[model samples]
Target: MDGLNWNDVRDLARRVAQGEPLLLTAVTRSILLRVAPQVGIAPGNAERALQSGATAEELLQEVSRRISNGSRRLSRTLADVERCRVAGDIDGARQLLNDVLAVEVVPHYQDILRANLAALDDES
Candidate 1:
């Protein structure tokens, strides 16, 4: 929650605006809880979205697409994080790679993610 970023809030707002059910992973949920007060959206709203059975993956994809298109590196980072590991844990060398992506712009981030994924494939 302490590390909650503005991108998370923007994504939550977009989901609310789209009438998309909130599919919050635990980390995402924590971010939302911290941001709810600032956005004027209640924590209950996110809970309700979860209760309504929204697919978090779908919502995350939507957010990623929007962010990617908008040239926001943070969105790309989130997507990379989501795809790179399950349940949000990017350990070992992957974690180091993600840290680099986290500060990049979208265009650069996309290239980096693609390269990283390819490297992973090469390893496999």
Candidate 2:
């Protein structure tokens, strides 16, 4: 989250767009591993795809989709969390944060979820 590098993402996309073969060179592998999680695609999932002969184009498309959907999902879920808290349903709010944290792989989103959960704890 702290050292987010959009240049890496753009480079990957450029390679894919140019129809470059996705050879698992050390540099390529590092980019794939690092950018995957930052964009909300789980690292394990990306690794599996890469190992299973997925093209860079295919992976890029999937990352794009995940980034879009993940943004909406986080926003909606956070809204629900706020609703629960406003309704005096602390347990419900905690549960919502916990649920997000369970599947959230992005460090920034995980931090947000954890912070919300901690706020609920403070209120208690």
In terms of TM-score, which candidate is strongest?
A: 2
TM-score of each: 0.28, 0.63
- Model 2's alpha-carbon lDDT is 0.75
Backbone clashes in model 1, listed as residue pairs: none
Highest lDDT among the candidates is held by which one? 2
After superposition on all C-alphas, the RMSD of every candidate to the true structure, in Å, is 13.6, 4.4
**Per-residue lDDT for 1-124 in model 1, tens only?**
2442558657665776688655556767666455443333345654554443354444344445544454555455556655756554445446746575565443444475668756655554
lDDT of 1 at 103: 54
Q: List where candidate 1 sits over 4 angstroms from the true fold.
A: 1-4, 10-23, 52-124
Task: Score candidate 2 by TM-score against the native.
Answer: 0.63
For residues 25-119, could you state the per-residue lDDT of candidate 2 as single tens digits?
Answer: 77877777777888777778778777744665577666655555666778988999989989999999999889878886666778888888899
Q: lDDT (0-100) at residue 1 of candidate 2?
A: 42
